[model samples]
Target: MHTEPTAQATATTHPAPTDPACDALDGGPATELCAPRRGRPRSEAAEQAIFAAVEELMEAGRSLSDLSVERIAAAAGVGKATIYRRWPNKEALLVDVVARLEAPAPVRTSTDGSVRDELIAMVEYMRQRGLAKRSRWMLKSALSQMNSWPELREAYQEQVVRPRRAMARAIVRRGVEEGVLRSDLDIELLCEIVIGPILLRTVLWDEAPLEDPGLPEQMVDAVLNGVAAPPPDGRSR
Candidate 1:
């Protein structure tokens, strides 16, 4: 079963100001706080509208370079200032939109101690996500524009890649700790071993509908158990 990656950060009150006046009558500096207090709390309606606008534009064949703050503001029916307040630029907005899209959840370590099974499940989950129609389009869009928009690439790496990699690395580390995998294994390399083939087939080759039901299990087996034939019963090969 797939479980969504939980938010690592929690929203709590910011630390009280160190300024001595903060402890006095009026809370903190009015000049600093009152300015923001005037606006409505960020509207979820506006946020979703903006995300939909970007996706709709992309689906209509507009590249990221073709998008502008004004255009998005018009599309979302919110003021340009609203968009700017949430995302400083189009690249940042697109990164967030893509990040929030429905995709396979990261695979967490299983409690049953079956590392191989967990690895297979993760591979399958990633495969499903990568082969999804919307995901494929998003990947294509990102790849085509990433060369010209370095910040877009950076945002993607920061928001999506790092968290996913962290989850994969953690699971690999757990395998080593449980003696299911070799102690000397490079966690990063192990992660690539599991994800590399799917990426190669789907992204590099544009292979569609990656429908091999056994692919995930086969991949995990190849990584955990060698491809070499086993020795005959009672004798070393």
Candidate 2:
């Protein structure tokens, strides 16, 4: 997603010089002619190596402040240019690294699935994410560091938090439209009702269990059906 500003600006401002060969081939002036690319394509292997290197460094107890692009390049076995080509700065790189480690779960888009089913899927994804060792470590580290690092915090919010929140809100809105969720409730509140418990267990309480496959279903059904018992006369409290 990162681009070299100078190179990009130069390419935009100055088109390639007209080529005589291209003009002959086209039988017209080659004002739109393009030069052949000289740079190699991005290597997936190198990118993976860089991600792995960051994880390895973190696993070795290196703090965020300690991880420089130079160290990452040395560990990844790529030149500094390779890292710069992919990310504008260390904060961007680290944001990507966290995203890779977390691996955002896909939201179900199929129309055949019920609103309840989609809610369960979303909650289950969080449960599975919480169970991941690397993801848990990265989440804890990122949350603790965000307060001190505004750039990293903003990047994480824009790249990670905003997207996830948008997806959750979309799902809740759909449920309201389908009459599965309360129409009067705010979309944000409905989302919190469905997923908040799972998040509490997953992020706030490390000791809380996420191993139960039935947990997501239980949470979703509880929100849908209510936890309160009927009064003796079956009247509203």
Candidate 3:
């Protein structure tokens, strides 16, 4: 669902990359991420330590489940107060990480003039990203946590999902405006119907293909053909 936003260049503002301190946070040394506010600036050292500890621990499939605050503090080489000050708990930390994750690019449109081609490309994009091995697990985990943590879930939707949805809506509007797609179609429900197959495979049925180049085309033909308005024949079935 995460195609890049078209408005990112014009709608978003980027701060100047001048300050060495801020640059660290932007992907520089990173120590500047935790520069203390008033009192000698809290050590940026602990933030890096915590990140390394989290990454390494997660790589092994080990997590904060059995690990306590004291243990994570020790592993991160920061005081309990330090970790708590930034993140109330491990879930809070994970929420931030998930929000920062980058999604894959959308599927390409092989033939641009046809609405059918656009539909196929959209489905193809979803298939490509939805079939990811570990990302599926990560998605499921995040969805499960949402019910328990509303604010974190809302932030994830805002950062990750909303932009993707907006892109899809824009594409649908373009399709209709270009005269290739029917104007009567309901964009909102259409989005659900369009994406339902791949999502069902990825999240529910758990049967995404490892490689299926024609899969998107097939999905588009099936959904599009069935939903298109009645034929000109005027011979109602």
Model 1 TM-score on a 0 to 1 scale:
0.72
State the number of backbone clashes in model 2: 0
Q: Which stretches of candidate 1 lie over 4 Å from their true place?
A: 1-41, 107-113, 133-139, 232-237
Instruction: Give the alpha carbon lDDT tens digit for every residue of 1-237 in model 3.
Output: 111112222222211111121211222233322243332223445555666666555555654354456666766766777666666566556554553332353533333556676666667766765565345464455456576767666655544455456555656666678875577879877777777887777557655563678888887777766756676997766
Residue runs of model 3 more than 4 Å from their true location after superposition: 1-53, 60-96, 99-103, 107-118, 133-143, 208-210, 227-237
RMSD of 1: 11.9
State the local distance difference test value for candidate 2.
0.70
Q: After superposition, how far is residue 126 of candidate 1 from its true place, in Å?
A: 2.1
Count of steric clashes across candidates, in order: 0, 0, 2
Worst 10 residues of 3 by lDDT: 15-24
Tens-digit lDDT track of model 2 for 182-220: 999878888888889998997789889888999999999
The parts of candidate 2 lying over 4 Å away from their true place are: 1-41, 133-139, 233-237
- Candidate with maximal lDDT: 2
- What shift in Å separates residue 149 of candidate 3 from its native position after superposition? 2.5
Please write out the lDDT profile of model 1 over residues 110-219, one tens digit for every residue.
Answer: 35647777677667767776666445676556556877888888766654555555556666777888897887868788777777887777667765557888988888
In candidate 1, which residue pairs clash? Answer: none
Worst 10 residues of 2 by lDDT: 15-24
Ranking by TM-score: 2, 1, 3
Model 1 is weakest, by summed lDDT over 10 consecutive residues, at 16-25
